[model samples]
Target: MTTLLPPASTTPAPGGGACAAAATPAAAATRRPVVGSVHSWDLSTGVDGPGTRFVTFLSGCPLTCLYCHNPDTWRMRDGKRTTAADVVAEAGKYTRFIAAAGGGATVSGGEPLLQPVFTGELLHRFKHELGLHTALDTSGFLGVRATDALLRDTDLVLLDIKSWDRATYRKVTGRPLDPTLDFARRLADLDKEVHVRFVLVPGLTDAPDNIAGVAAFAATLGNVSRVDVLPFHKLGEAKWQALGRTFALHDTPCPTPEQVTSAKGVFETHGLYAV
Candidate 1:
């Protein structure tokens, strides 16, 4: 079973920390945004719904997931220094297209939570000024207390649940599981709309018992609008090679359609709806 730690007594304070303070002004200036690394944008990932989406891959993540696709995003000092407004302006050009098609901006990355100030500011502008649908794709590794302010204007959360078994979770992401589970539950309790995502890696997260465990836990979340079973792929292998890091899941096979079908069924059976 997933264990949830008691809600933290204090919420993380609003405004930028040293990291944000140091980066924001520069970002605000030349739009030469720098975080960990400023990699080129790939408009793919298929996360944005039905419309033209503007996605920003922020830098820095806490987890070292074995199957991490963007291992390059792990560092905290490599990206360009673009302000929140810079991102919004660029995304604004496509706003008309995104709106007509029912899509908007999605902030994804090395864990957008790692850059809370920038993410918060960006979302704030998106909602109050641009009036766009904002989506946050995160691992939920950053505890809820740290994220309360950030979620205020977020329209949707694409939460990635790495594992149901704590031990297995640590093996997969090199981090404890409780905090992530707590983050998930807190979002649910707050009535925040969320879509749970699980990457099904054969022999790792694909065991029937594990799938059932995840489904059972997800079922308890009253605000989960959908559960997505993302089949494992080797798309990030080359990226790892480019970054001079060993691809840990090199031998892990992608899940068969049967596995995806079966896993989806498990989620449905447990009362957690899947999309």
Candidate 2:
């Protein structure tokens, strides 16, 4: 999940260009403008990353998380075709405002790593060309797809550590929990700055043990600079209806303020900053 800690993609698209295969940094720079399936782009503050960020939401994701708010981004074909250059150019317009706000740019997805080459191109150009701080928001399921060159351009990572309990994690994302953990350890090894995100769903992911599990692991990472305890909401329920898919958590209530505070406390107890 792109920090929508949302389920996103890594399965290569069928067509050509960056969506098809990995490309070296030199290849990405010299090759024709890398292309990708993009959902939308917008400016937002607080949640995505530090400052006021120009966030790009790429298309396609492999997992089908039950509480996904952005179900519309689940498929590559559903998005409009665009190029990395075009996306960067769009972000370029906000460089001044973003800089003033102490923000930069973020490449999020259905999964950015799903389209590694295109994503890398966007990040590299965003940092090197636009002179902006860049972040990659992902679930880390496809962390293997993120080449070293890509990580070089990423100043921060907004990672969704959905659920620490294996069974709950699978029930929530329809995938095993290990890949995300593996990726977390890898990021720590690289000493990458990471902001861990956890969605506090009252019934789904609010168990004390689950929260403790995630908190303890994140504290061990040594590279996690912040933790965001996001509250669950029905904001994306309408999108699910439009997609003709049942919103599994339609009746699930958002986490209470107390629950959110307690969850944050768990991380704090582990010696990690939480908000």
lDDT of candidate 1 over 1-275, digit per residue (tens): 11112222222335867674444332443443322222333343365432566777777889998998778878756555554655666777777877887887787788888877567776767776788888888888885534565687788888888788888899999988888788888888789888889989998988888888888988888888888888989998998999888898899889889889999999999887775
What's the lDDT for all of these models? 0.74, 0.87
lDDT of 1 at 198: 91
| Model 2 alpha-carbon drift over 4 Å, by segment | 1-27
Clashing pairs in 2: 1-6, 8-61, 8-62, 8-110, 9-61, 9-110, 10-114
| Residue-level lDDT tens digits of model 2 in 223-261 | 999999999999988999988899989778888888889
CA shift at 170, candidate 2, in angstroms? 0.5
- Whole-model lDDT, model 1: 0.74
